[model samples]
Target: MKTVILRSQALQGATASDLSAAVQYLIGVDGGGTGTRVRLSDRDGVLLGQGESGPSALGQGAEQAWRHIQQAVQAAAAQAGLGELDLSRCAIGLGLSGTGVEAQVEAFSALQPGYALVALDNDGFTTLLGAHGGEPGAVVAAGTGTIGEGLRRNGERAYISGWGWVCGDEGSGAWLGLKAMRHAQQALDGRAEAGALARAVWAVAGQDRATILAWCAAAGQHGYASLAPLVFDHAPNDPVAAGFVADAVSELERLAHALDPQAELPLALCGSIALRLSSEFSGTIRARCVSPRGDSAEGALHLVRSALQR
Candidate 1:
């Protein structure tokens, strides 16, 4: 793969007359573990319509995910009043979670003929691009998992965390949820004092300790991670919940430190959980970041536009 480097300002201004002229339709898709989102825009970047579907990416299986993407694009196009839009003349931008892997890439490549021009990359890459307005910068992503990436002024790159939920992702929603569950179990078993964390878990899983245990036994890391919002909701008056937040912030800070301690540039806090905790976590992460200019959908569009220009 060839690396495409552009000045931050230049990247933001990228366009393609050829692609634009052929584009009676344009679609940007952001496919992740949680779900998929589609955005339709005109040649000039005017928003036309949007749609959503369940997770879509090769890692989730090519046929199934592609079906979802097809449905989403069709819905968006229909809403945009371009019901019979030709895929052959459409410019497509896909930010897909699993496509970075070789097998996944091959699967995506096999499906490329479905559209005029298609660009596929890991969803995180596009998220960073959109968060920074196509600028060279960094992002800390804390959702079901945690990861950080940076693009230096010289076009070099650095990364931290993102080892996955079990061994890494220390500050992620899955981590926090796991901690909360452990605390709850410990409290029930008389190994620890019953605290706010226990109460929060019980409230979400039900009041019975046995029910909570059963839920934990059946659920995977992602299921546990789903409880993070409950933890945050209880944090204001709950010391244990507050501690979880503190620890999450500390882990995020570690990720930031691993990138460049002294380097001062825009850092974006992305992903569902990170976006929610930005105010609290920003202080812990040291260098403050700017609000995301857009989400991964916009970033996918930005990348597609840049690629066409090149």
Candidate 2:
């Protein structure tokens, strides 16, 4: 029965023929604030080639991000021995941030000319799709920022947290780093309990208190969030750092509860900081959550394949 269904699907695809002549390459691209990654795969989802580049979608403007995406795609295609291939022959699936803006989305959509089928969505959606193998689940990302999103079994979607750095992102690396720095500054000013946080920040920045303040004036939110690892490094021995982790875990737990009142579904943690703090953070959630099965690129490939299958 399964074989028959598979054969029928194959026949349907062949009959449709929209992508038959194009070599049916599944291309998945993930563009985030930090970087961009592209993956090329065969019809069966076997990854053929992959390439990465710096800060594609969020950091740069739409035109620049699109250019980066094109370059990464070209690099991957070339690596897969598909150099000089027609863009229209490829099925492109892009998961990107900052494209949700009307102007950006329109700009990106216009760049999809050569592809037979193109699907573009926020990178978070693709991350969730990849983490859960296209199944319904939730993901809490905690890199420069934090956000939580989930898809229920019935295809209903929910998002909890992800208010960005200033307003939200409770358990994110950015949050942790920000908190740590604040505490350190407070301590330096004799307003807070003394701990290793101040020393750690000074050490990481290789500067004294006055110099650190000057740096903060010019550094952006992400720059401060980059220091989160130092907090984790000191968590085992430093009470202030440990307190920050605990606070992060608490915030994430609140986010999980917001997504599901019952709060017992599987949640996947993505991004560098969330993964690093999983042991400490996961303990706060009663639900059965796990790490992502694959990266966003794989999820993007899955998206492309699903489009082709349809």
Every model's TM-score: 0.81, 0.81
Residues 138-185, model 2: lDDT tens digits: 887777767677889897877666555666678887688788878777
lDDT of 1 by residue, 1-310 (tens): 2222222222234355644565555678888655789998887888888989877755557876778888888888888888856776677888776554677677756655456567776677778778888888888887877778777888776767766566677888888889888888888788977877687787777666779878977766567788888789878888888888888887887787777676576888898888777777556454567778998899988877776666
Provide backbone clash counts, one per model: 0, 3
Worst 10 residues of 1 by lDDT: 1-10
Best candidate (score: lDDT)? 1
Report model 2's TM-score to 2 decimal places: 0.81
Ten contiguous residues with the weakest lDDT in model 2 = 1-10
The per-residue C-alpha lDDT of model 2 at residue 58 equals 43
C-alpha lDDT of all candidate models, in order: 0.74, 0.72
